[model samples]
Target chain A: MRPLELRRIPLFATMTPADLAAVATVVEPVNYQRGTVLFGVGDPCAGISVVLDGIVRLFRRTPERREVTTGIVRAGGLMALCALCGEATHRDSAEALNHVHTVEIPTAALHVLGQRCPHLQEQAMRGLLERLDAVNAAFVIAQEQIPVQLLYLLRSVARLDQAAQRHPGDTMHPLALRLSHAELARLVGTDRATVTRALRLLEEQRLIQRKRGHVTGVVLSTPDRKVPV
Target chain B: MSDGGNRKVWYLRHIDLFASMTDEEVEEIAHLLDDHHIPPGVALLDHRDHDRVYLIKEGAVRLHTGGPEHQVTLALLPPGRMFGLSSTVGDADRTINATTLLPSYICFATWPKMAEVFARYPEVMFQLTRSLAEQVFRTETWLARLGMISPTARLADLLVELSDEFGEPSETGRRIRFRLTQADLARMIGVSRETVSRTMVELGRAGWVARESGRLVVRDRDALKMQANS
Candidate 1:
């Protein structure tokens, strides 16, 4: 394996060739087919994993047996940094949303890597802090009424996806692509019927265009209007 | 230690929120208490205003408000949870007025000191944020379950939650030693007291549950599980 390619990952992007080689020594590369279960709740997490390619969805099954998708881990982002410190248990399960490639580094190797590379240490610490902050923020936002929560989340994920564009007459940046009704509903914490009604309301105001797989564009429309459920 | 001092420590120990805090942190926080004791019937955190946040160290505190005809209990914060977070978040005022149910020893934390501690520890900040968020979600979830779900379904969901939190293994079933009064059940599920009474009676008759003096003996866990599924 060409260890030089390891430098392409965001976490190791700043490290030198020598540093990457040191990391490549302990990193075990693994690939999975779509729909694979990487781990489940209560399984011992030996260390952190970084997505080299493909998407992984992390979700928890509530006591009522409802499956709540907490987050999706995309390529270039690190997953499970808290496992390194052994502070959090595997409260959620990780499943491959698509055929995926990841590098699994044992906790011992991560500590040694951190000790060897100050850059990795700082990156890991900052990443963990930011992830915790995001999770806390998500918890707060999710508690709102489903419609309010969905609109807020759509704008957020749109911005995160880099499709956000400021419209002259509105406060929120309109997302350039239309999120499929089902995908939009899942993110918004509601059923498709509610999401469909919400989108239609927005469409009537010309705030957004609804198309297959994407919205044509977001436009300045009106003030924040509550979707009548 | 003085009688008052030892009682204060004993009270703080029972609060789950304080369990993770260090002794030094507790000692530092205790300095804010001022050895103040309020007699029963006094309002600690009045409805609709910013004031001191209190941690009960001795005696019971009933979080309630409204006039004689409209009064309701929000919570009976025994000794762990801090009350008056509305003030911290800039709520116009406390939504529920806390009254001394019995003579109580309470510790007060001024806003500045609270901010200082939050700034000093990221872990504390994370925990506090998550805890506050969870409290809001829990309250909302309870309200939604009561409003949108059937009483039997709500009771089933409550059983599932309690089983996860405090169930004990038994020969017949996983017994839940829940010590909630009928009034507490009404407040928790956001239903009328009478509805809670009727629901409990029906559940008992259905053989899904058996009620003792103040606890629920879940006899048919599988049946309740089916109800939750349905």
Candidate 2:
């Protein structure tokens, strides 16, 4: 990537032109197909991958082979910076939730660049702090009712609609969520039957609306006008 | 430096973040820390207090969230671990309240001081990043356990984990030195106190765990490990 392109990232916004050029020399971009395992638990940490596009889900599998979704890394997010310390292995598995484009920074290169540029080090620290926020949020939601938990999950994974961005006067911001009921159940740590019931309740409350013929996806809108569901 | 300052520097060197640093660097970081002696039942870092990190030098601290009537214990941080990391990075607010479980000795550093140290030693920044990431991974695992597993399994897993983190070898098996109540265990596992009570009774009857003077002693390590994975 060009230094100009690297400068576009908020994490690199504070980097000087020369620093960006130094970073651009070492960073490599890679693409991952959907469902591809980026790295697995116990795998050696090659470096850090920063999401340039699409989504990556970090998760772990239980002894029974049940996959538990931990958190999703969206655009401009950093992955596995935690393994850059003295540790040699990844703590959990990261898979491509969709087609993902990421800039891979080798561990040695990151160390060199961080020493040369304090801005990058601060940004990396801030990124981990943001991730901690997400983990804490998930822990809090785990104690809520199934429906509330489902709603929280949807809100977390939903993508903002372009239309809402174009119209500043619009009161509602539409968000698109693409996940099957089973997937939603897995994310919420509940069964499909319970998910179905919860989705129905959310729909009745006008908090979520399913797209026609898209059984696996739904759209949620901000409450523009309050009407009793 | 006084004897107390030397002792504080000694404790600082044991922390993972400072363990690899040169003695001079550790001393520099130690000088930035303000000593605090907090009694039990006092909030060391309350919810919403930002821009400070506390390194526990001695005693236990409980990190918890929610109001008193419906609070949850996030983790019991032991000596040598740091808390309030969220405040050092940016505007992110602390989600949990950290309270001393026993009379404790703590060392604190403001965000500016920590940032200065990171700028001086970038490797420390990387180490801190990795530490926070480990914290995230652990929290995610706990959430998964709370959401998917049975209460018995959850309790079993908690015991096994705590023993590994804070245990000292004993004649029977391993003893968790921390004094954790059934209510605190319930909060950690996101279960009811009654559930913890019943599960403890079952484990006690099966000779897996025993209570000695309000502290838990893991008597049968193999059985508890099996229950944890079961």
- Considering every candidate listed, which one attains the maximal DockQ? 2
lDDT for each residue of candidate 1 in B57-175, tens digit (9 for 90 to 100): 66667665444444544445554446665521111121456777567787787656665655453344434433443443333344334333466676777676655544666654566
Question: Which 10 consecutive residues of model 1 chain B have the lowest summed lDDT?
Answer: B86-95
Error of 1 at B45 (Å): 7.4
The whole-model lDDT of each prediction reads 0.59, 0.76
TM-score of 2: 0.89
Tens-place lDDT per residue, model 2, A96-196, is: 86788988888878777878888888888778777877777777767768887777676566542345335524232344546778877876667899988
Question: How well does candidate 1 score on lDDT at residue A34?
Answer: 76
Superposed model 1: Cα runs more than 4 Å off = A1-39, A46-58, A62-66, A70-88, A94-149, A159-172, A176-178, A188-198, A216-224, B13-29, B32-106, B111-154, B160-202, B207-230
After superposition, the stretches of candidate 2 with alpha carbons farther than 4 Å from their true spots are A159-172, A213-229, B46-49, B87-95
Chain B TM, per prediction: 0.62, 0.89
Error of 1 at B61 (Å): 9.6
Cα distance off (Å), candidate 1, residue B44: 7.8
